[model samples]
Target: MSGKRYRLQKTERLQLKIKLLVAHGSNCWWCEEPFSPDDWPTFEHVNPLSLGGTWSFENLRLTHESCNEMRANHYPISYEVK
Candidate 1:
């Protein structure tokens, strides 16, 4: 390791990252809700973190809880990236 320590624990970091990710996106990727800072939009990863993804702006997206759950463990091949 490079001797850097994490300011937040793994769980805390994941929570914070999800919050910030939704805030930065500001709307559901599918439904287009008017997201607010207080609103806890579902956290979505463009590439599954379990598959070696990282916490980056480009990898984050805003989604509804139901949508996120439905898409979990599934990847769509025909998604139109814009």
Candidate 2:
């Protein structure tokens, strides 16, 4: 296992979470489901940070905690923006 643990600091992570809430509202980027208040959310890197993705808004997504676990280190699917 790669012992390197990659992460954003607490405050920066919180900022990213706030941005995710604004950008995606209650939607889960991986599963496309609305988030319930009880569901904990996580920041998903659309482009895997391990593969050189930046911690920028354009590359981040809001997802349910479980969904993010399922999507680790993978590129997200593309869709035409309407």
Candidate 3:
């Protein structure tokens, strides 16, 4: 991976999008909102690629475009389910 943008081919992008969608559906990772018909889907970086996060399926997630934008590069705080 290079600095700045994490480049991906169209096929790769589509594949990633499909994988994330399957894993998380069309929900917003940050807000837990259901996707709207007019909403666009985007990849939310769990740990933030800018902060040394990998672009792997484990780190990427499906989210509403607006939610991803609002969250920016900030990873959400996780609470233990115990």
lDDT for each candidate structure: 0.59, 0.73, 0.71
Query: Residue 70 of candidate 2: its Cα lDDT?
Result: 70
- Of 1 and 2, the candidate ranking higher by TM-score: 2
User: Model 2: how far is 2 from its true place, Å?
Assistant: 25
lDDT of 2 at 46: 78
Pick the winner on TM-score between candidates 2 and 3: 3
If scored against the real structure, what TM-score would every candidate get?
0.52, 0.72, 0.74
Candidate 3 runs further than 4 Å off = 1-5, 78-82
What digit string (tens of lDDT, one per residue) describes model 1 on residues 1-82? 1222323467865676666655665677756675666665765667666665555656667677766776674454544333
Error of 1 at 11 (Å): 12
* TM-score top scorer: 3
Which portions of model 1 show Cα errors greater than 4 Å? Answer: 1-25, 36-39, 78-82
Candidate 2 lDDT at 10 equals 92
User: Candidate 3's residue-wise lDDT over 34-63, tens digit each?
Assistant: 777688677777888888887777777877
Indicate the worst ten consecutive residues by lDDT in candidate 1: 1-10
Model 2 lDDT-worst window of ten? 73-82
lDDT of 1 at 70: 66
Tens-place lDDT per residue, model 2, 20-81, is 78867878876778888799688777777788877777777888888877766766664322
Model 3 steric clash pairs: none
lDDT at position 10, candidate 3: 84
